[model samples]
Target: MSTTTSTTTRSPDAIRGRRLGVLLVLCGAIFLEGIDVAMLNVALPSVRADLGLETGVLQWVMSAYVLGYGGFMLLGGRAADLFGRRRMFVGWLTVFLVFSGLGGLATEGWQLIAARFVTGVAAAFMTPAGLSIITTGFEEGPQRDKALLVYSGTAAGGFSIGLVAGGLLASAGWRWVFFAPVGLAALILLGALALVPKEPARPGRSGQKLDLAGGLLVTSAVILLVLGVERAAHAGAAWTAATVGAGLLLLAVFAAVERRAAEPLVRLGILRSGPLVRSGGAGLLFSGGFFGFQFLVVLYLQELRGWSTLETSFAMLVIGIDAVLSPTVVPKLVARFGNGRLIFGGLLVAALAYGLFLPLGADWSYLVMLPGLILLGLAFALVYGPLTIVATEGVAESEQGLAGGLLYTGFQFGAALGLSSVTAVAAAYADPLEGYRAALLVPFAAVLAAAALSLPGLRRRAEQPDAEALPGAGAGAGTEGGTPAGAAAGLEPARG
Candidate 1:
């Protein structure tokens, strides 16, 4: 009989080197998925000209992809838990690359749009599944934190590269951009196979039944919502109202299905936690506001200022820099102000940033945008790590995956609706500055709402003892069996 001896003397350098290797793979995969998100947008105009497409057909290219990504996000998170993460990772990567190549070869808008939809479906699996890879590979705490920072860093960096590439490739012809990601995808796929650890068989793996009805309803709802917002400028009040009602009805049904499903896509109780609830709402609001600022200014830069695509791309780098820089700054802010203060303060700053943009017009200089960009970037920094911490902080270790998915999903949906909201307000008013001014108000309102939601933590419920004892409280998240102690505390036992 042999007894295995546990060794605690392994060198720290060796352990770190291995982690570094794993982090690169995680970052690389995540970067590809993210760049893909905005990469095609950069090339859209070129794609339209090349395909000889009518203006109306161009909508399909972006819409198809967004529809696929949003529609499948909830389902993808659960799928990772069911199928082996490595298997899904490889599967999605293969499909994403294939579609990329197809889009490159396409001669017509229809072919490109179809390919984009396929790519989005492939990416839905790729992104969250890629995230699952980070979850299982890095043991939680510092190592995990470091790796996630790197992933965020990579995503931010990729967006920058996407801008540069979009500018260069649009000049060189857009196919180069498609080919670039394909080559990058091939490299990442090879590295993943060799480096990504094999995931264990899931405890109750029935290979994802995937609430089809729920998925379809949610997808339709989102599409209708986006379309309604886009058409607000064209559709009469009656038509828009009808679209809005139908979308809400669809979403309500989707929620009900999730509430009762044995393997619900979204665990509704997770939202019951005060912190998660606050984080979700604030995230939605904040992203909406952020995107609104971006959309309004982009138009100002191009339409009013007569900036070329390349010039605008370079100017936009300020926002990109701040987006990438925030994760690095968050930990220090958390140490100083605590999560709640940072969150509130961040929103306050963002509201101010938007206020600065309201006075601009056709005569605006590049210098005028700087102060707002700096303030906006600072606000962005305040949110990244603090919100991420709040989101997963109280999540049970087992539910960390769910928390991560839920947290980002809030941002994604918020981004979709929020950006749309800005467009609607702007279109409604017809005055550019007035519309942007109104859109900025959304973030300000969200900051107030988020603050109210968080105050409950400062109070004690009659029977509930201390705030720390709250189920799904911050302290309870991400503990035990590599799970967050909080979000998982009341979660139904691990789905088998």
Candidate 2:
């Protein structure tokens, strides 16, 4: 199914302006998603105090969202392809808006959790739709590259800025955190209605059917996997083991089902593309390391050092500098070094940042941690956009949403794994300081492994002919032999 926008007789400059409007609308939607999550995290303590909830139940406030998001993401992505990207995005954004407001007015703990879960599911659908729209709308070249860089930078900035916003809003009242997104979503929805172009009709899309069996199986498997990992730090060993083992078994079954299905929800062949696969792996490791590190930092500053939430937020705000650098600095770097080298370098710098912070002192000043924070921000600026470009570059337009789904699935699972593993390790030690020191190694090692994973791609790019090696060449040069092996068979290049 094609997602191309219909051509008009508008002037070139007019078309560019419309495309820019669409990009901004989509970026606003993503920014809303990022800040929504960050704001809720900050307000959790207030929710617990107000609702008088148990610790385990309070934790579910966050876990429910994660479960809903991670589980349904693959299904959501494929739905955009089979249904319509614009339809899915607009519909889901409305759902997100309503539910976010409901969460704000929630009088009971379960009410809030239910609202958050639905909101998360809405995001699972909306985010990929927005991303796929950008991928399909922009011609794959320098133009697409810059659009993606700006989109990613906005998302990072939202989360960073949300930290400060959340703290300030929570001070007013916890409900304000939930209410704030409502306003943002309403504005973004209006922009989307006005700016997002209508999807061109595909010849046979109306007759196409989604692989319901495959979708069900894969969704179940992902939900189980995410839930098992999330419960690992809290649940009993036997329970966690059984849950994860069952998830793996279901995944194997899902794989078998996809191979036999007449129209599989996911095209397994796309997984064979070397660059796509590498990008997915790198995304997983990078997110895992970054989030795990952030989690550890929060704990050390708040619990260990008795720092206020606002104080900690300010200290970590340095990492948000990526929001500034990604759209500006990284594009020039990508033009010179290509995505592969930049991703590798980013991973190495992240590892170095983690290593520099390995020493855990009770009385360490903010000055001591400042350099590491700056390095991490730079590393994120370098990695996030390039990884996104590599993941979707050569995939068929029909499966762009699926490609996005696969990438984000890795990121979500990696985050769950990293957070769970480190929490488990930290709990094992009697000495709090010693525990934090040991936990720090988790992110450090994960980043090093990510760097190692990127090496092969760099070497292959180095060996390629100069003409083939040009930045953005693989994306739009032509379809002759540039497409991935599976994509070359029947898939067509995306139409602008």
Candidate 3:
């Protein structure tokens, strides 16, 4: 009788040391990506002054990045799954690093806009790839939650940090903002290649071809949808309707393509799962609704209030501080009250924060806004982790990566789409402040929707067995993911 002994080989990233290294690399990538997203907004006036860009043209510099980031996010997510995650991650980081230099070197307005758009594409890859790594590397539950906090926190915090960094760099010369991130990216890429633990190929699945048709359709649909929302302001009422109609048509086609593809770009069924639908709803609300807040406030501070660029950046630091500590408290909340009451409570809290801003007039002090923004950040902290956990909970282990990517897709695209809609509203109304107030209500409506989506999951959880809380409902022992056993995680286990 011959019995075979099988050896298990793990990628460095799949282990502890490699995981830490990769985490650091991802943090850098996330920070750089986020910084680019916000950096341009902070320094737009400087760019306008330097390149002779008209005031209206300056908005394009910001939108160019958003369009690329939102449009291609899913494609980027697919790329990570198709190619090795590490290969694509390193490649994207390198591109972003290279382009920061290009953006810095831009001598004309169009040149800078083009460079910013390309950087957005590079960011598309880095964001998903980093998330894929985190989701693949960590197990579900508390451990994974910690990493998500860090990952999500970096994005939230980076939004603020970008402004600070942009101010300093812009003062030196607006180009340095581009130059500095490129250097850091190069360093992070090298470290990521060396330290990011790579997961071994799954036994049944390893290689697959790209769904080019699906990618193009999805990307184009997202871009057109976002643009139409923005264009509804001035493109004539009929053009607005047509643009939206066309966007919907492409999106419907993209859905069909995904459903029929041999290796579908998006796993449609997973997206429809109970937890994921709710999580996605929350992501849509927060990412879209909240994203516009900073964009509007930065303008209010710099242009409307006449604060120095650096001083304005310094003021928003409260959000990062609150977000870092907020998520850690979530597990305790879940343990005590369950997800339903808490999530609804959080959303209502966030709505209140945004609503408070509506009443502020031209003479209102920055101090008044600070408290509301802090409350908003705190509300975000409460909902972020639990919602992420719920999003992946109902799926089988093999599908976790796909779901992770999709949920994030909703997150990025929703925010981008939301911001565009709000911007159009503000611009159309011709009273930027009033427009901001009007837009504030949109997120409030969105949170109410998220609360509705999450309610079902919360009720469902009440009926599941305690063992179900364990990895693969306790079938998997000592595995990172909650599967039959021997599975690894994409990110850390869900925290708290």
Candidate 4:
């Protein structure tokens, strides 16, 4: 009789190596996502000149992508769980590749915007699937922690690297910005095909279907919410308020629907996980504060100091140190201090970084700015990876895609809110310097609020003997047959 032991037991090194390959593939995809945005931002002037586009139409190129990405994220996450992680990831990646190439070939502004929107939708599906694969592939604890840290670091680095790359590519032609990602996406797709493992066959769910109604409500709500925020800087107050209010109403309706659905798109109980909830909140604040700060800094350097794109990129490149420290230093810190303490500490440091920069002077030398930049990088290294780990830690494997989606949705929404709020604040002031200083407060306050939000997690950690013993932690903890102990009951097979 053949035994299962021979097939199941592999050398530890082989497993480690395989997992490493998977991690690299996922990291590449995430890095591509990060870089894609930054590169496009840098190329906007060129794109406008080439297409003879108005400023309002040019802005749509970016806004279209954000709306598509944020709107469908939750649906994409659930789709991965229902369909298959590898299938969603691989399929959407192909879509991303195709659209990116189309974007490079576009002759008009509208065509480019359309291409970017579809690419963003593709990313919405692919990113969560990639994240879920890592969370489910690696066992919880040190191994998973290390993988996540490395993944997060690569993502952080991608933006910093993209700035320099965008400058170079834009010099060549704006089309190169779009063309570059096509090549990178192709490479990542090849690697994913070779490395990303297929999902194991399992028994089909009996009767549950995808919650189409719930998905539609949430997507509409999020799209409206993001659109309102994005337009806040440029649109009138009446329009923004109406859009935002409608979004809130739809969100409430979505919650009510979720409470009664037989197979809800998102299990509302997952939100009850204190760690996950806190992590998501913190992620929102962290992303908001960081992006807002970056926006102000870019304006200061480019508009105020008359710095070139390359010069600004190089100066800001110091902040990319998080990319290096995340993979190498953060794992050690997480092992010693725990994710909660580190997140708290990171927020504190981010607040300090913003505080240091609040005294911005028109004539200030780079030396004056270096401390704040360095601190910001350190804060990102500490916070970003830990937030990701905490968010996904307690979620069931089947729902990990959902968890990733929720975390990233918070991040995207926060970025939009932070940027728009700061932009509006800056525009209100007569003096440019005064406006920037006033705007700086937005991120500083946000970081402090995030620090406050993380306090409950630290308290919970202190009270629990085993950190993983928290109410929702069982799904991620050691379990028989690679499934969470209690997850089999409510799960229905996903419809293709």
Measured by TM-score, the strongest candidate is 4
Candidates sorted on TM-score, descending: 4, 2, 3, 1
RMSD to true structure for each model, in Å: 5.7, 5.7, 5.8, 5.0
Q: Evaluate all candidate structures by whole-model CA lDDT and list the values in order.
A: 0.66, 0.83, 0.69, 0.86
Q: After superposition, how far is residue 124 of candidate 3 from its true place, in Å?
A: 1.5
Local accuracy of candidate 4 as per-residue lDDT tens digits, 1-496: 2345653464321235556777899999999999999888777878999999999999899999998898999999999878878899999999999999999999988899999999989999999998888777776667678888888999999998998888889989999999999999999999999988777665654355789999999999999999999999999999999999999999999999999998999888777677778888999888999989999998999999999877888888899999999988898888788889999999999999999999889898999999999999999999999999988875666678898999999999999889998999999999999999999999999999999999976754443223332333443452224563222212211111
The estimated TM-scores of all candidates read 0.83, 0.91, 0.86, 0.92
Model 1 spans > 4 angstroms off: 1-15, 202-209, 429-496
Per-residue lDDT of candidate 1, residues 132-213 (tens digit): 5565455444444545555665666677567656777788888887888899999988887776666434454454566667
Q: Judged by TM-score relative to the true structure, which candidate is superior, 2 or 3? A: 2
Clashing pairs in 4: 205-493
What's the distance in Å from true for residue 20, model 4? Answer: 1.1
lDDT of 3 by residue, 65-91 (tens): 767877888888778766767777888
Between which residue pairs do clashes occur in model 2? none
